[model samples]
Target: MERPTRIGVQLAPQHAPMQATIDAARRLEDMGVDAVFGWDHFFPLSGDPEGVHFESTTQLAAWAVATERVQIGPLVFCNSYRNPDLLADVARTIDHISGGRFVFGIGSGWFERDYIDYGYDFGTVGTRLDALAEALPRIRARWDQLNPPPLGRMPILIGGKGERKTLPLVARHGDIWHSFVGPDELSQKLDVLRGHCEAIGRDVAEIEISNGASVRDGIGGVGFERLDALHAAGTRLLTIPLSGDDGPDGYALDRVPAFLEWRDRKNG
Candidate 1:
């Protein structure tokens, strides 16, 4: 059976105050978004480079208990930031806090500023991906060894667009694969992912395909027009970001209700 199309909101954890972000999260859940996400980065990706920002896992714990019914996670946690075993434990704890409503989104480290400011090695792409590959097995091992285990199977969402390292990792471990690629690229990537899955005797369909969507008012450039082709190419999930920078009032969620309604229309 095909998975129902789902809508998620990525609250970028930038520009706004922490309280505002949390409040926005609760509001989004009430407004019927299926999932809520935060990006893992030390500083703001937009607005003032030194603008207000919060750590992903520390805040994800708070978000877990703040909103009922919405799956909560980082859009993609950087693998280089923490020890794999500790990361697994943290994810498990948040999973327990949410009563099993957690989706673990992770990816190889990127953003040179994050690494430099935080004093981690800013390695080459190959090295970072290799670290991620080594870390995945350790995370799985740590999860198995946790006292309570995770409250559920704990879906892992892997984000990256590379066909070489990223797609193969998605084939082996990811429950969801997220990327910014539109329909055309996604179709080609699916072929690569299928080849990887075939090598392992796994079914490519077992991994949920995901992409970003633009707001109705053109707040984001993720291209809502391509949504149909994206879905036709096998994307089952879409996420839109809400930023305070969208306007002066706050995180501009005024447009999100319509987007959620669109999700309903698609599901129907």
Candidate 2:
């Protein structure tokens, strides 16, 4: 059966005070978005790479209590930032607080500054993927080893677009595969994912396909026709990342209206 479309918003944890960030999350929830996410990093990705930013897990733990209805998580937690077993426990605790509304989004580490400044080993891409590959099973095992386990199974969302390592990991382990790609590119990668799934004897449909939408003119640029194509092609969860700076007038929150409208129509 086809799943209903869902919209998620990443509040972009950059250049904002904690209170403002919390308020933004609450507002996004009240506006009827399905999930709220923030990226996992010690520094801002844009503006200044060394600029002030909030860490994903800490921010998410606060967000768990700040909003009751919104499902919250990191867009993708860097696996190198914390030990796998410890990360699983942290996610479990947050899941309990959120009443099982936490999606454990995780990925192999990127960003050399985050690693070097934080005193983590800055390894090669192959080595990092290798680490992630080793860590996944251990994280799952540790979850089971915990006294109560997770609030639920704690759906795993794996983010990345690497065909060689990341997509295979998604095929084998992820409940949702989140990535950003243009429509044609996404279509092509879906084919790659299918090949990965087939090699592993796993059904590709078992994993929810998620894509990022670029919001413009208070609406997503791809429009309803493109959205339909995505849905028909197995993209179940679509998210738009709204930065405070993405607007013409600065700090515009109007994107949510068009996003919600599209989500409603697609789900209907």
Candidate 3:
């Protein structure tokens, strides 16, 4: 039998007070969403470039205590931000904090401002992906050596749609593959991922597929509907990102009901 489809939400880091962000996550968990995600980036991705934004891992630690039940993770952590070993250690710590309810979502670094301001080398895309490729095994190795092992083997989530480098890396290391493109694009990518899995001798079904939901008018769009299409296409995990710092006017909370309604229907 097919697993019931799952719904995940990316609570965007920009524009909200920290406590409000925590509150929102709790509310989502209360409403029975499958997972709650936050992205890893030092700077804002949209809205005012200089707007207030929360950092990923710190907020993840907060989420560990703030909510129970929902799996929590960075939608994709920038592998360039921390050394691979350190990233693994941090993930392990959060795993313990959440009593193993953690997914280590990661990807090659992007966002030039994060690099330049933080004094990390901002290399070309090829170089960054090369770094990530090197880091994956090292991170896994270090996780094994930690004095106290993680509660369960924490799942690794690899985000991105890069065919040659990213998908192959996903094939080798990921438990979940996250991408933002639509169904048709997702179908093609999955084919590529499957081929990579075959090359590596890994069963394609071992990896979960997830995508970002597109929102419009605070009511709907491809966000939830894509779950059905993605499910039909063998992509069961779905994520919708809410720009958390949308101000006291509570624009971000407006979408919660739609998410809840969709989830309730799925559960029903």
Counting clashing residue pairs in each candidate, in order, gives: 0, 0, 2
lDDT by residue (197-216, candidate 1, tens digit) is: 99999999899998888665
lDDT of 2 by residue, 187-229 (tens): 8899999999999899998898998766652354545666666
Per-candidate TM vs. native? 0.96, 0.92, 0.93
RMSD per prediction, one decimal?
Answer: 1.8, 2.2, 2.1
State model 1's lDDT: 0.90
lDDT of each: 0.90, 0.84, 0.84
Tell me, by lDDT, which candidate is best: 1
Sequence-dependent TM-score of model 2: 0.92
Q: After superposition, how far is residue 41 of candidate 1 from its true place, in Å?
A: 0.2
1 or 2, which is superior by TM-score? 1
Per-residue lDDT tens digits for candidate 3, residues 100-165, read 999999999789999999899999999999999999999999999998978888999998899989
Report the C-alpha displacement of residue 241, candidate 2, in angstroms.
1.3
Clashing pairs in 3: 15-245, 16-245
| Model 1, runs deviating above 4 Å | 216-223
